[model samples]
Target: MELTAALRGQTIQNRVREVGINPNHWYPVAWAHQLPPGRVIPVVVWQQSIAVYRDTAGQVHAIEDACPHKGVELHLGEVHGDRLVCPYHGWEFDRSGQCVHIPYFPPDQKLPCATALSYPAQERYGIIWVFPGDPQLADSRPILEVPEYDDHNCLMIPITGVFNAHFSICNENTMDVFHGFLHKDLQGWFDPVLLNLQDSNSSVQANYRVSYKGTLSKFLGLSTNSDGVTTRNVSVHYQYPHYHSTMEGVSSLYLMRLPVGPNQTRSFSLLFLPKVRLPKWLLRAIKPVLVPLVLRFIFMPFLEQDVGMMESEQRTYQKDAKRRYVEVNPAIIALQRLILRQYEQFMQQSSQSNPANPASQPPFESWQDQSSNSSIEPLTVPHSGKGQ
Candidate 1:
């Protein structure tokens, strides 16, 4: 649905900071190259710990981190051919998590029926993805499409971000274009005005008109004249578990989020820039030097600043859960609503699937009652300036 792009004060929903992710979607765990054949690594989706391993055949498999027999972490085990061998008892499990062999078992006796819970796993776009929810939905729910992954013309730079904040806080930081002032010294965009906003049950898209100037702007092809200001539209799309944002036609960023827990979030992002027109051979030759230079000089500074702000916000929220804060961005408000809705929907589906399971009940149920009202009293900030 379409939303007004008015910057009006709205009471922030504190529950958004505590909500859990709807796990039906595919989540990125590790870089494809990081988990080579015969390597096992542990990854967490939301709060569910998973053990992902690549077999000798180069196929990836994801199983519950805990071994069913003794509850030892499966990631600590070894990979032997197509089976994952538990460290403690030497129990061997296949890709489907079925216990196929137990070294200590006698040849005459049949092996006991034991299996570790397994998840659907795949490798795409140089990243390893796992389906942490219902296996039935894995094929239907697709990973985010990245056309630039194989496009030789675009310079693809992979970035990793580990934030000490909730996924909601980290997500809002990306959707917020008005915070450009934080990176002003770094020649970031300025004078950001929300141009349009749209939201749905699982997505939020915000467009903003932002002005850029200085040498960094020229380097990014944002402006031909370094000293003169150039205005452009930045479109940010928050599609459930991931994000895709574009700076007109100059660049595109696909940020895939992994909600590790309530207090931590990880992002695997691929940034594509169209400024370089060099041949594939030359581009590949200079990629090693160029990737680090761009990351250090252009991206890391902005990410560091964002991380500081997000962590600070989380700390403040943790200190006083009921503390009220006012938000001026309507897009942020919409994002909060969408997040809540997705979590609630997931809870509802889970409850219906297993009605007897009390653990399936939604967390922060009181927030649903309070948020039903269209508006709440806005809290006033002391400074009322750019920093707020």
Candidate 2:
């Protein structure tokens, strides 16, 4: 549904900070290159530990991180052909997580019914993705698309972010363009006005007009006149587990979030800038130097500032979960509602599939009713004299 473009103060709910992710979607676990053939690494999605490894044949697989025999971490084990060998007892498991060999087993004896839960794993866009929910649904749910990944006209920069905050907090930081005030010293955009806002069961789309200035503005193709002030529209799309934001054809950012636990989140982002377009040969020559330089001198500073604020928010929220805060951005509210709804939907499905599982109950029943009212007003930033 469409939402109004008016900013208004509303009581913020603490329940958003406590919600868990709907594991039915695909999540990026690690860069494909980071996990070499015959290597194993441990990854967590929504608190579920997984051991991901690439077989010698170059196929990726994900299984429960713990060995079913002795509860040892599988990541510490070795990769033998297509199976992962547990270090503790030399128990070997195949890609399907079925125990195929035990060092001490007799030839005539049948193997025990031991198995580790296996997840659907795949490699795409230079990232390893895993589906932590029903394996049948993995084929239907699609990964986030990045059209600029293979485009020659766009310069792609891979950015990784580790934030010591809840995924909700980190996600809100992306939707809250009003926080540009925090980056004013870096000549970030100002005089923001929400132009459009839309919300659905699975996504939230927000568009805002913002003014830019300074050398950074010029480098990003955000300004044209010598007066150094240029206004552009910024659109942010939150498609549940991931985000895509663009600035009037100047730049595009696709942020893939990994929720490690309730207190930590990691992001795998690919930033594309049209201004940095260059011949493929020249781009390859300077990419090593250029990617780091832009990331360090340009993006990292803004990221550091955002990290500090997000972590601080997490700390305060932890200290007093009941503490109330006023929020003026309607986009933020829509994001929270989507998060809650996804979790509830997952819990409801889990209950329907297995009614006897007590764990399938929604974490907090109070929050279920919270998703009823989904209307939200748009965010509006106060105008500065220079921009107006």
Q: C-alpha displacement of 20 in model 1, angstroms?
A: 0.6
Where model 1 places Cα greater than 4 Å from the true spot, the runs are 225-227, 277-281, 358-362, 366-388
lDDT of 1: 0.88
Model 1 C-alpha lDDT per residue in residues 274-337, reported as the tens digit of each score = 7765677898899989989999988999999999999999999999999998888888999998
- Per-residue error for 186 in candidate 1, Å, reads 0.7
Q: Relative to the unseen true structure, what is the C-alpha lDDT of residue 368 in candidate 2, on a scale of 0 to 100?
A: 41
Candidate number achieving the greatest TM-score relative to the actual structure: 2
lDDT per model vs. reference? 0.88, 0.88
lDDT of 2 by residue, 104-137 (tens): 9897889999999999999988899999988999
| Predicted structure 2: lDDT | 0.88
